[model samples]
Target chain A: MVTAALKEDLPGAGREISIEAVSHRFDLEGAPLPVLDDVSFTIEPGSFVALLGPSGCGKSTLLRLIAGLDHPASGAIRVDGAQVGAPDPSRILVFQDPTLFPWRTVRANVALGLEAQGTLKTEGHRIDAAINLVGLQGFDKAYPHQLSGGMAQRVALARALVNQPNVLLLDEPLGKLDSLTRLAMQTELVRLWQQSGLTAVLVTHDVEEALYLAQRVIVFGPRPAQVVADLTVDLPYPRHRGHPRIAELRHEALRHLGLEASW
Target chain B: MASIELPLEAGRAPAPVQGWTLLAALPWFAAVAVLLLVPDLTYQPLGRELALIWGAVGGVLTLLGLFGNRLGRVGRWSALRGPWLFAIGAASVLWTVVTAKTGWLPQPFFPTPQAMLEVFLYDYGKILHSAAFSIWLLAKGFFFGAIAGFLIGVGMGWSRAVSYWATPLLRYIGPLPATAWLPLAFFIFPSSGSASVFLIAFSTAFPVAVLTWSGIAAVNRDYYEIARTLGASPLFLIVKVAIPSALPHVFVGLFMGLSTSFAVLVVAEMLGVEAGLGWYLQWAQGWAAYANMYAALFVMAAMCSGLITLLFRIRDRVLVWQKGVVRW
Candidate 1:
């Protein structure tokens, strides 16, 4: 399995990323609607964190800011130690949709990140191995159209994994899946994280999903969003859904999120 | 919720192989058998020609049928995807055969299909040279015109300022068909072939430009945003993303432009060009050599069919995503 250390190490030695007073705004009512006001956070090296929030909160926007897919209206965003300006291959972002290029088959799509890096011909077998790691071995030649929603998303995950990003950012990556597939993908993602050592930060409205996957969950309140709560998951690897502590923590997280209990 | 592995070989289903040559030879065997058994069926001029043409047609159909494993390989067969050249070839032969039997159509008096085939085989060196000239004219007209139009269209589409300034002016000129430019071209151009080339270029450029512009306009906003987010250079976006994404639409323009250029060349050739399929067609018609006229018509049909077939094949191979097919 490839590791993120292969990327150029960000200077200032220890810091993985830092967001300093970053804020985002949009024009609403012909005036500024502060979606994220003075939002400040820091992600430590090799951390598995989740940004949790209710709908319409700027959780996804925060993730995008760190990935440099969007600029903060104010203040600085840094990856490692340097300021964020644009998306770098070293910080891969996976969206809710698979976003696999439809013209390419699954293997080709999975290999594309490496292909873009001009390393595929020298490391093509590595791509195959990554796909195999994601349990998508048989789907190597299948077109995106031919795969199920779950399978296609797995290919997207494989594509991201193949890049060996220092920071793996996901924007509700499992929100579009059926319940069973979402559960399966969450497990697969955790497994991938342990094996590949990706510093993952996922943003989602699903409190349970956030709690289930992350080492630490950070919940943000509605617009002008800021971290309202942070909780550590002390459960071991392959945590069971039926565990009493898991349920209690999930309910507690949801309650703080102001969402009615659905489970 | 454990990650699961699927069997690597589960999805593949092997395709059946077929023998097309054997299938084509079946009709030949049948025709030979009929000729041997019935002398009455074998001893006529029209019968000989029908047998020859039928052998060719049957050969093609048998090839398709025998290679049934490959015939309907994938995708739907709508009008846009039909085998137009094959239809044209079959139509040409059918017209010849029907005209021969009924004498209903104004007739050609020169040598028949058998004669042309023999001429094609023995005097091919000379025929090939003439074919080369005709091909050159076709190429010159198509390439220069299509390229000019594509570039102009891409420019117009990419730049709103250019489109705003140039659209009305071009629209005014585009309606005037290339052939209509022939009279003006006659006085201005130094030679007949050059004039034909200019006419074809002007004719083809308009649609190419129009198609290119529309193709540019059709680019999704998301793609641009994606490129920008990736920090792609302006050159990279235009060369890599914009051009490829616009290709399907540009090809439509090119195919139509090519067909139009060829058609226009026929009328253009009649002006003063001494050689070409169109020139030969007129030569035969002037002498009332209806058989030669028919033969030339057959050749022209073959050329057009060949061109369209070639373009479709190239398009299919290159634009695998587009999945264009030849129907009928």
Candidate 2:
């Protein structure tokens, strides 16, 4: 029930998102190929949710719809009772590839959102703060090519964070990182979400990652994806990898994804 | 009260004197010797004067080879080996030609290098004036063409409608050589100078526009999407994302345009211009002043290379982030 003014003024001022019967399709050689089919979900303000599904299940597409980067073929996605039409700085989407502008330094890339909004002169300090928050200190002048995969992703995170968005849509943000960096970044992501107190919807195929970070997991079906299962983790902070309860939840999530509990 | 004494080594290894330095100096020494010992077989030449100048050049090279290590940091004397060889070869060939020993290539057509050098010394003022005028014309044409081409290219890239209309026209008109329009250009413009300028500009514009269009078009869609999500306006996306991303391609276009402009400049100047390197070349050719023509050619080569090097320097500064990613 947060008002638009309140959301605009405050950092991490969460906005309740209610997506009703949203569907999306892509045109492939003059053919309408269904991607998302009648997907309905509600994300509470300041909550962490994970959209878990198999590859090609339209999880990322759903996030795109909510971010207003694309319009749903049918139904509507609303943030705080207002229908989403176009992309806004209030909802930032971080993609799998860092997608950082190669010509700009890390500092300049992080300042993009502010610069676009013409608020860089006033809120310039936030760029440095966001870089610091992402643990990318002392890399202000580093170019994208100079960075490691994890560091580049951290810069991408900082770029999104500098806007102080109410919702952060993550599409496999750490998918390209190595196992060790992935494990570390998972913890970092959780800490960032907790500190910011903003609604987060992460689209991941990793069952363990979903269980480790998100409070709610929305499993999606194959192709014309619809909600298969909606489960709550209800786990405590700093959740152990080998915890019996987490292991059981992992099995459940895998079952919903139509995969054997291989792990 | 007492000075501490350090033990001295019984044997010390001698610092290696670079042998390549001596190898580089041998050719220059030979060149100087040839110039001095060999008498000119031609009637109109002074071999002694040529020998003195070459002897000075050879002496300098020998000095560089001998004391190059003392130059500190700039002590890479081995790098000069190739240039040293080239100079020797060129000098020997020129000595043979001017000496008329072979009688294979006669004068008026193939003048001696010294004769060309004499032209440089005698007519330097005229050469300088022509060079200055050519540079001014080149600058005006290049800037105007580059600016116009960039604008048109950006528009074509940003809008489908603009691309739809302009793309076909560009394809049709872009490939035609700038020289082909000479007859029409002469009549359309008020003066030949302006027409020449227009021709230079026209030659430069096509490649720049075409490359820019492609550069902008080739930019990844993900960038536009990301920029849009971050609240970038259409203008912001075009300026910040599209332009910066397409800069590498724009530079490619600029390089192409620059080279073509030079070609067009020479042709344009030759046609009707009163002063320029190309004009000087035409005038020299008309009067059978082959030495002056060769001198002007040398000037044109140096100027073109200097300008290209300047462009590369600008590219390096502006595209600093693309350091190791893209190399010349």
**What DockQ do the predictions score, one after another?**
0.15, 0.80
lDDT of 1 at B192: 89
Which candidate tops TM-score?
2
**Candidate 1 off by > 4 Å:** A1-15, A27-33, A115-126, A138-140, A261-263, B1-132, B149-176, B186-190, B216-234, B322-328
Candidate 1: give the TM-score of chain A.
0.90
The positional error of residue A242 in candidate 1, measured at the CA in angstroms, is 1.8
lDDT of 2 by residue, A86-203 (tens): 9999999999999999999999999999999999999888887788888888999999999999999999999998898989999999899999999999998997887777899999
The digit string of per-residue lDDT tens for model 2 on B204-253 reads 88988988899999999999999999999999999999999999989989
Q: Report model 2's TM-score to 2 decimal places.
A: 0.92
Model 2 chain B: ten consecutive residues of lowest lDDT: B1-10
Q: Evaluate residue A165 in candidate 2 and report its C-alpha lDDT on the 0 to 100 scale.
A: 91
DockQ for model 1 equals: 0.15
What is the per-residue lDDT of model 1 for residues B1-328, given as tens digits with 9 covering 90 to 100?
1124356634654234333334434545455344334444112344565466656755655554444445554211211223443454445454444444344444345344444554445545644555567778888988899899988888897778889888998889997888888888978999988988888888888888888888878876544444443344666556656676688788888888888888788888776678887887787678875555555676778788888889888877767754422231
Candidate 2 global Cα RMSD: 5.5
Model 1 chain A poorest 10 in a row by lDDT: A6-15
